[model samples]
Target: MLLFGTAGIPASTKTNGDTVAGLKRIAELGLGGMEIEFVRGVYLKDNMVPPVAYVGKKLGLKLSCHAPYYLNLNHADEVRRRQAGGVLHHAAGTAARAGARTIVFHAGYYLKGSPETVYDAIKAEMEVVLGKLLDEGTEITLRPELAGKISQFGNLAEILKLSRELPGVAPAIDFAHLHASTGRYNSYPEFAEVLNRVGEALGRESLDDLHLHVSGIEYAKTGERRHLNLAESDFRYDELLQALADVKAGGLLICESPNIEEDTLLLQRTYLDLSPRT
Candidate 1:
């Protein structure tokens, strides 16, 4: 079954409140998973992991993580490149401790190089990071997310290629990013093509065990500008859900809308209703 959840905890929680409490609350809401938003940085202390894991296990909530946005695998400076690798390493470690299976990250930006050159540099850096994680015995998977702009290092084709080359790497296909990056393709046939391509390139197992981010987004010629709430944006989510159900894609689908919990439930309910058996 496909698990649906919000990108982070409900906004009602105070900044000083407990993160474990947030996990329990999400489970209480009937959500099946939560993407711990380490987008700013990794802040989960070692002492908190046991309690968080306990709560997650009791509640049956699947866990995933979003790495910080500061990563840049293609940095021109060697020092910066190594630092980026360290960031990924830290994120991977934290994800494993939190009982999360996948750690999603924005790979990098394409500053002034050709796409091919940037892709090669990013792939090389990812290999180094993955090697370190494997040596350390971390079981978490590193997911390079499909970014939401033209200037980002990750596109569907580029990320899929990287996943093919790297042993443990996978693509986090953000549907909002896909829509913004291409300016269109929200229909059932278009979405099906995406699933077909991924299945063909990465294998059926990869398609079944997907990690996705979905929301309504505003875009321009340059690509995604900002995320909008489901009701406020023009995202054709019904068709998208149908496409996922059609493929029987089973993994975490995290909602990044402004009304996070509300949109997440909407997606879960919509998917259930649109599912083929129904």
Candidate 2:
């Protein structure tokens, strides 16, 4: 049931003026969903929301969102930490209005603090964000992505814990980040092991509607350098997709590579070709 798609508006779109057009282009391209790239801000007007949601529904497109990238929940200053909550609130609102069920974000960095302390700070901030989203009646899953850098707060264990404890939360698994972060999991067995851990920690139901980011990437020991086109990089995507199929993981797998549509299509075809017969 995995839906392969682009991270933003498809590069092949005839018109890229609006997200509705983008969704239409995604549907036209035979893709399944698109992530609304609110990497800078999440400010969908009251008038603009319905049309975006409407077009997605009409076209049978699954929608998800990427919240602003710079939000740091573990900011030392209370003002900035609180500001992150406000931004997440708005992101949930935007996702709700756009018929998206998940809002993925890079939670924060671990600056000069124990990993446990950083985790507490992020958890506290996320509780506030989630509580507000709940009270406001905007139902959306808040996913803290596994970050690529060594300095980042989210690791696989941390994100899994957050998803386990927080209501309406989950990990947005980016295989590129995993490979970049650890310099591991580039093999079939390792990929399967990651899925096994996910299933063990979050249960099989967590595999049902995964939010994933897949790409070929370059990384150093410190972690992620940049994304590369699938064929250009040595990322074991074919093996990863095969692992996903074996685990029966189904959901949106958005391509974040520089060439979004081409890589997305490549991923979809590879997964399908590797899949077992019903």
Candidate 3:
């Protein structure tokens, strides 16, 4: 039931083409979805939303979103924290208008705070943001991504707890990040454990509607350095996909490799080979 796609437009998409054009290319490539990357900002203009939604609907593509990189909901500075919250709110509104199912973002860094303190701060901040989104009737799912670095605020347990405690919030499970962050979870059993933990923590329904990011990653002891093509790294994507298939996990699996469309296709093909469900 998983829908495979790129994080943004396919690389083969024509230069100067918009996301509407990207949707067409995704449909042509047989991808079932795309993540509209608001990595810099909510760049999908207000005027373009209808068309983006229309094209995505026509093609049966599930759209999701990644918020800007700089957003840190638990920033140490009050001003920056408020700004981050504002950006997230704006991004969610736009994504919802465009028919996106989820908006993924990094929650924050650990900085000098204890994990307990950081988690509480992030939860409090996100509660306010979610409250605002709800007041505006914007129901787009908020996904705090499982981060790749040790210094980052989010980890598997942290994300699970966040999703468990927060309304409108869920985990954006990045397999590369998990592997890079821990130097483990690169095997079928480890991958299966992750799925089991999510289901255990958030319920089986969460697994049924998972949001995932996949890539081959380079890492140091500190954590993720960069993304690599699946063929170029030790991500064990085949086993990871196998674990997903075994669990019957369903959701949008967005590929974030440098070779976006190619690796996306590889993930789709490999997952299909492992599971009867498309």
Per-residue lDDT tens digits for candidate 3, residues 1-278, read: 89998999898999554899999999999999999999988898789999998989989999999999999888889989988989988888889889897999999999999999999989988988899998988879999999999989999999999999988999999999999999998998899899999999999899899999999999999899999999999989988888899889999999999999999999999888886333
**Candidate 3, clashing residue pairs?**
none
What 10-residue stretch in candidate 1 is worst by lDDT? 10-19
Error of 1 at 77 (Å): 0.5
Off by over 4 Å in 2: none
User: Estimated TM-score per prediction?
Assistant: 0.97, 0.97, 0.97
lDDT of each: 0.90, 0.90, 0.92
Error of 3 at 165 (Å): 0.4
lDDT (Cα) of model 1? 0.90
* lDDT at residue 17 of model 2 (Cα atoms): 51
lDDT of candidate 1 over 1-278, digit per residue (tens):
79998898866555534778888778778899899988899978889887877888888999999999998999999899989989998988888888888999999999999999999999989999999999989998899999999999899999899999999999999999999989987888899899999999999999778999999999998999999998989899999899999888888999999998889999999998885633
Of candidate 3, the 10-residue stretch with the lowest lDDT total is 269-278
